[model samples]
Target: MPQTPLLSVVVAVYNGELFLAKFFACLEAQAIEGMEVIMVNDGSTDGSMAIIDAWRDRFPGMLVIEQENQGVSVARNTGLAVATGQYLSFPDIDDDFKPGMYRRLLDLALASNLDVVTCNGNYVYENNRKPSRPIFPEDKLQSTGVMSGPAWLKKALDSRKFLHVTWLNLYRHDFIREHGFKFEPGLRHQDIPWTTEVLLAAQRVQYTNERFYDYYIHSASVSHKPDTDDTLIRSARHYIKILEMLEAINQRYPEQVKNIPACNWQIAKEGLGILHTFNNMKDPQKKKMIVKEFFDRGIWRLIWKNARGFRLRWRLGRRYLKLKKATRVPG
Candidate 1:
């Protein structure tokens, strides 16, 4: 058995052969000391397993867990169960981490004794070097500072850029372990709820302006394609659950949580988008089932309850009209 590592980077691999080499190259170049890579293979049927095997040969200490096609959430939880590190982070297989990112983040976290250390990331599009908007808005976090959990939560809720992502932060393993922070299994929108809960539980959170991670945006990603029935329904259901989570957090820490209405409005817009996707589907059976599901679960009622903004209300009204037309059975 090898000595313990300072940080454990958990990766969920599923048919990621195309980008495995690049990701491994970046990982091999990290200057961090005593770091271990814990990768969970979610039953990748492609050459992903082969690539992982090659890397395992090269790095004898790398921990790899194999499981049937459960989901990314289960893969991550599987990793968390056995990770033997002081700190933890989860990076996607397709993204790039700038050299020394782990080292820098670790330095910050250790120096400040923070529960979490977060940095900025660049959203790299295939055709463009720069995104239209910055991932971390200039005004959101003015400088390197330490903030209370409540302060961070309020700011994160106000600005879309404030909460960069789960992967952009370094979390103490003990902090997560104490709170029992596990990603919601079988849900694609696991990051939002899990991150929100972690921040709520954290006492001190540190932020830095260094852009150390690259988030590659592709057309094939789930967030970019919600047209299909399964994707649309899953995303909509997750959004409702996320809203409920935020509401619960707000109630638990009423004085700390601000802009609940704004957060609700943003999530409600996505809910409307899901309904629109269902409305545009051509398959009548799946469409009818989804429509029935939406009504049966009172999704529309929850959406209407939170549609406060004028633009959101307008969009919700339009989507509801289309849903009504789509749900009407021919006599």
Candidate 2:
């Protein structure tokens, strides 16, 4: 019989002192046997590193690797390099897992012999728990959707239903390593490409309608912070690059062309959504500047494409143009 799994759970952290204890406690409570919890402290200045150090002594199998201030992707990649698990999972230090999350997810992943095994997660903030919002076209679970890597990705992308989330799944170690894949070191939205890439290689897949992850809405998360940073622009560039790469992949897998529409539509809408959320920005100058800076060649084309289909989009395009005019950026 195979030796018990040394499942490596990598928790990526950077100044996550506020939630470190709860996160580790959640790890401790996981009923999965023979697991190693690898914590990556990505140059946290806060008490986060100290907290992890304390736990290093407390948790017998815990390993801590310290690095300079790098992004979450680098930290995760570092963990991946040293991980000895038969299976791999990524967890954010600010998130928690339901009881037996590892056990249930691992069982499904191994049983299916899949490159990837995904599960649904519940969104929890404060005291509220809600179903994980689907990132795919339709929110329906195929009563355990399973597919070949290409087939599954094509369907999900066409349906606009792929969640593109990193934490909601488990992956085979060899598959990840053999593919020469790692989280993008500095890209803010690294998961989009990483998940899409791996699903392209998945031979078999599995899912359970279980909400075993507690995805917390915390301000400390880089994604939740103010968007007026290099991180946003950098991540946007990364996203665009991924799209270009996928276009090349589509040449090889002609059936996945439908993913193009879903990607472009969401990119256009979500770009606008980001601006909408910034209605709370207090400084008009900053807001105007941000709006002006956010637009690019592709975004302008997306706005134009979407505008033709919806009057609301046309109005937005007009507003966007006026902002660009006011900001006096060359068209």
User: Best candidate, lDDT-wise?
Assistant: 1
lDDT by residue (tens digit), candidate 1, 152-260: 7667666655552678988999989988889888877778777766877789898777888888887656577546766665666677676666556556755544434
- On TM-score, the leading prediction is 1
**Runs with alpha carbons beyond 4 Å of true place in candidate 1:** 1-4, 57-60, 127-133, 139-141, 162-164, 219-226, 244-255, 258-263, 283-285, 309-311, 314-321
Stretches of candidate 2 above 4 Å error? 1-6, 57-59, 127-139, 154-162, 226-255, 258-264, 270-331
Cα error, candidate 1, residue 201 (Å): 1.9
Q: Write the per-residue lDDT of candidate 2 for residues 1-331, one digit (tens) a residue.
A: 6464548898888888899899888888886666878888889889998888888865667888989988889999999999888889998777778778888877777777778877777666544444445333125545356677666665565554556788888888988888888887666666876876687667887767667787777656666676654444445456555554444444554554444455445455555555454454555565556556556535555545533256557657666655565456443
The alpha-carbon lDDT assigned to residue 106 of candidate 2 equals: 79
